[model samples]
Target: MAAGTLYTYPENWRAFKAQIAAQYSGAALKVASTTPAFTFGQTNRTPAFLQNFPLGKVPAYQGDDGFCLFESNAIAHYLSNEALRGATPQAAAQVLQWVSFADSEIIPPASTWVFPTLGIMQFNKQATEQAKEDVKRALTVLNQHLNTRTFLVGERISLADITVVCSMLWLYKQVLEPSFRQPYNNVNRWFITCINQPQFKVVLGEVKLCEKMAQFDAKKFAEMQPKKEAAPKKEKAPKEAAKPQEKKEKKKEEKKEEKKPAPEEDMDDCDAALAAEPKSKDPFAHLPKSTFVMIEFKRKYSNEDTLAVAIPHFWDNFDKEGYSIWYSQYKYSDELTLTFKSCNLITGMFQRLDKLRKNAFASVILFGTDNNSSISGIWVFRGQELAFPVTDWQIDYESYDWRKLDSDSEECKTMVKEYFAWEGDFKHVGKAFNQGKIFK
Candidate 1:
């Protein structure tokens, strides 16, 4: 009965929640991504958009009656009728409990364990093992609960099942291999039953369960790091023992060196451009210089006391008006596949934005695993606007939601501490921090 526009990128799991609810309720939910409508990053980053959804996050909705809302769960519940939501007040409460369970119990460990396998995050043996144990514990609980139950709440599918299944979708598809998942037979059956529902199937077509458990490929991951050439060994010989043969060898080496051609004169246009280009002029040149030096802050935070000393020092000397703080969340999360690839995407962007390092300090993080994940970060830049310019090479910058933070706010202070420290439960994404890259 309700008609509205849902703004989000394609195949977003959060958006799928609303879409599935709309399907069951016959709510006219039009995807904003269709032609002449919305483009992730660009449209959302505009000043006009901030007026509507100030956070600039996706799965944002605008109803025909001028009702506007953000956040996936709220939008989904709004789209659903009493049947899909819950039959009774008790059922509704139970449904909410399961939804909360999915966020709290299942997603954190699931993301930590599975993201590294997907290559979105670098794997740490100790952390990954702990994550696996946590996942096993959560799954055991779910399996025990579902042993006699058809659904997460009551009979028939509800918002609880939809939200939970969507939350666990990537776990089943990415790293919950048969061997790992076989112990939780009840959970598997419940998941299968839920996905088979026409509403789920239509929204999430043909869910492919993981065939083989994807293990961390270390050598392949090592290859991703910039390699270092081995140091040449020194050969010691008595100077007096120098002979004619040594001279001949030196001649031979000289000949070999002579045989090597000089660097190529004709290079690709990109390389030529890069070579011809002077070191970038300071993009933040226009902004008033800050009294707080970034390098000092980095060294103090990294080397000195993190919370006790560094935080106090930062706030005491922070040039709030001169330097701006912004939160930049990765867009096109639906396009993210394989955990490693997602992390690589972040690394690649960081590498490409070589221009931003001098003026910006950021911590871009990869959360969750393959097929289901998100990349987001907090950026502190020299100027009051996004540091990266709009260009072909800078296209990736557009694929992020940017919001300025009030440096004086408690939320800003907390974000700085959590993001810089790379710890804390990031409630916005509903997943624990997996790994982060610091743009120092």
Candidate 2:
């Protein structure tokens, strides 16, 4: 029996394989994934841990007798019982074959497709679509092979089944929605059977299949971006050297301006005048000034109680003539995957639309759990038309279906109150509120 300690992160699908093997083999496997026992980033970087597992990746293992092992597959194989290793030489080779199949065929495409949905990786449309094809091919292979057999290599479950199932865990949980995975019926049946087993259940608990395919979340990718420190201010150039460069830049600008064509002699005075005048870049500059101060309302919403102060202030001071209320729903609800990722999408949109903050406010909400969710929000815009006047705001805006709401209608008020308060029946959403984000 292999009695040892496994070093890994919590809920790591890689570590689950070794833990599942230990369960079946009756090995004493103590998982060190939390504080005191182990701290992932810190512990893995330490010289002591690095000496045993040179690669520093997990699930690394240290046996009771000081036998050190690294790589999840190697550790899992070490912990597996004779039956799981396969009874005969031929069976052992078959087990190895299936294990290799899982790693080479299943994991790559699975990770490529699932990581983006979890917000762990940047999404590429072509790559993801190809990955879906690859996943289908891998599942098709498994579906055909498992058509008559109870397990991959032998009559009973073995390392092959364990490895393959662990490798496919994320794909099944995040992207393999019912309609998408319907073709692989045999693989599905086998997967359910393996997961429901005592050994697998001990490590994975109750596995939930994905009800809806998850999409790439831009918000998560943005949050994951590294925030670099500001560079030190550069010393000013010598005055004499700067003067000549400044004069040269000014002359270049003057020459460019002088090269402009004169307005057509026959052109109308209004048309020529309008053409000659420089256009202001501000999108909302054309809109009439409103009595409602967006900045003040934003402050109240942030600093005071929503129901008691903010909601009342909004209704009392709302400038319906100068502004408009609109309901926006994400067009691709069926493609939404994880709750956190969906929330990130909202955050990403808010960040990109920072320029629109002075003219607009919104309360976007994500509803439901991973693999089944929707996104919708109430927006206040400075003008009667949609607030996105320029292309920058149009990026994420076009993805949503926008509807102008009657500002004085009770139903609109009720929806706005619920969104602003981050609570309400939200009956139209047909899902429980998971989280919300504010654009101010």
Candidate 3:
């Protein structure tokens, strides 16, 4: 067994540590705090530390193989090899894509938006604004893609969601104001789902949505500025003539203290004050209860069969009125086009499905071009019977297995049916899936 020590802050650094601990239960994972006070006499910065990690960064891992690794993402990748990596080559590739996307796209903007305000890094107004803009832009890209799919790469939880999520944990905790995240609803929903997972909870603890900080107001800020002292009054001359008292008018006045309000009146005032205070709404108020049917569509079609036979059949026979079509693609397809245009194609399908009142969600993916050459995924319809036509692909449907879940019992056939009817509590299950493509 190898001993791995992570030198980092508990809050921001715990996600990575938790992932490793949860996945590789056999390995010993220790926390070595680097907050100057904690690290003063720590072994992390000693000569032995330099031998392992020259940079002396927190989260450097020394494997049982005597191989040492640094960089949180890389270390997480190394740690999650068997536990988080997909069983197939394609699954592994999707994981890599998501991890890379998290590192390259998510971390930069998050660091830019959060670090300065926390006083952890130098503040640059222009850079912060630019970073926010970039963050929104990147979120838009993710939202557009995630609007249809549950997870990032594969059919199950993968390293991609884990790593990128870890990177953004800081921003979600500190920087993302409600006003900022609300517009990115899909992103928010996805993030909430990820953090709420049991494994994540163990590592990251319960992630609460931080209250949005008050915006800077110029007038209020000015009011808060310390007032300057007025120049000392000019000293009076030493010699002063005595003044005679003037003749006076006669009037006697009595001063009296006003009585306070009665206890009943005070109670009413307190009640009024309580009533006047604004209450915050639960962001998940609209989220449906977790009840759904998982429909698995397995098809083996040649390139020509997918385009010439399968796709048209799907559009024509798909239960447009009863079921929603989620356009799914393999996480590993090289021929797949990567552009905003392809994203729009999927978005358009979702829009059309919205008209049907079937409450269908769709996601498209291109996986495995890297780790494995194969790609696959499924379009999940949450209703009763799929109203659409089944083309050539073999199809199977099963309600969410209640036996596996610890939450609700009472077999939820009605709940599943209601999900299809767009009735009852409807929650988003953003599990990653392995989906194959259907060409039209």
TM-score of 3: 0.45
* Candidate 3 minimal-lDDT segment of 10 residues: 247-256
Per-model TM-score versus the true fold: 0.52, 0.53, 0.45
Query: What tens-digit string does per-residue lDDT give for candidate 1 at 1-440?
Result: 88999987776777888999998889999998543597665576689887889977787999999899998899999999898788999999988888777766676667667765654444544445657887888889889989989988787888988888988888898888899899999999999988888888988999999998787665654543323334445466767856788886996797777655333222222222233334544556777768978767765664566677777888888887778899988878788777656765775676466455556667777777667778888888776666666223364777899898999998888888877666676667644324332212
Please report, in order, the local distance difference test score of every candidate based on alpha carbons.
0.74, 0.80, 0.49
**Local accuracy of candidate 3 as per-residue lDDT tens digits, 336-394:** 35432343344334333432222333323322222222222234453333423321112
Query: What would you estimate as the lDDT of candidate 3?
Result: 0.49
TM-score of decoy 2: 0.53
**Residue 126 in candidate 3, Cα distance off native in Å:** 1.6
Clashing pairs for predicted structure model 2, backbone only: none
- lDDT at residue 239 of model 1 (Cα atoms): 75
lDDT of 1 at 248: 67
Error of 2 at 278 (Å): 46
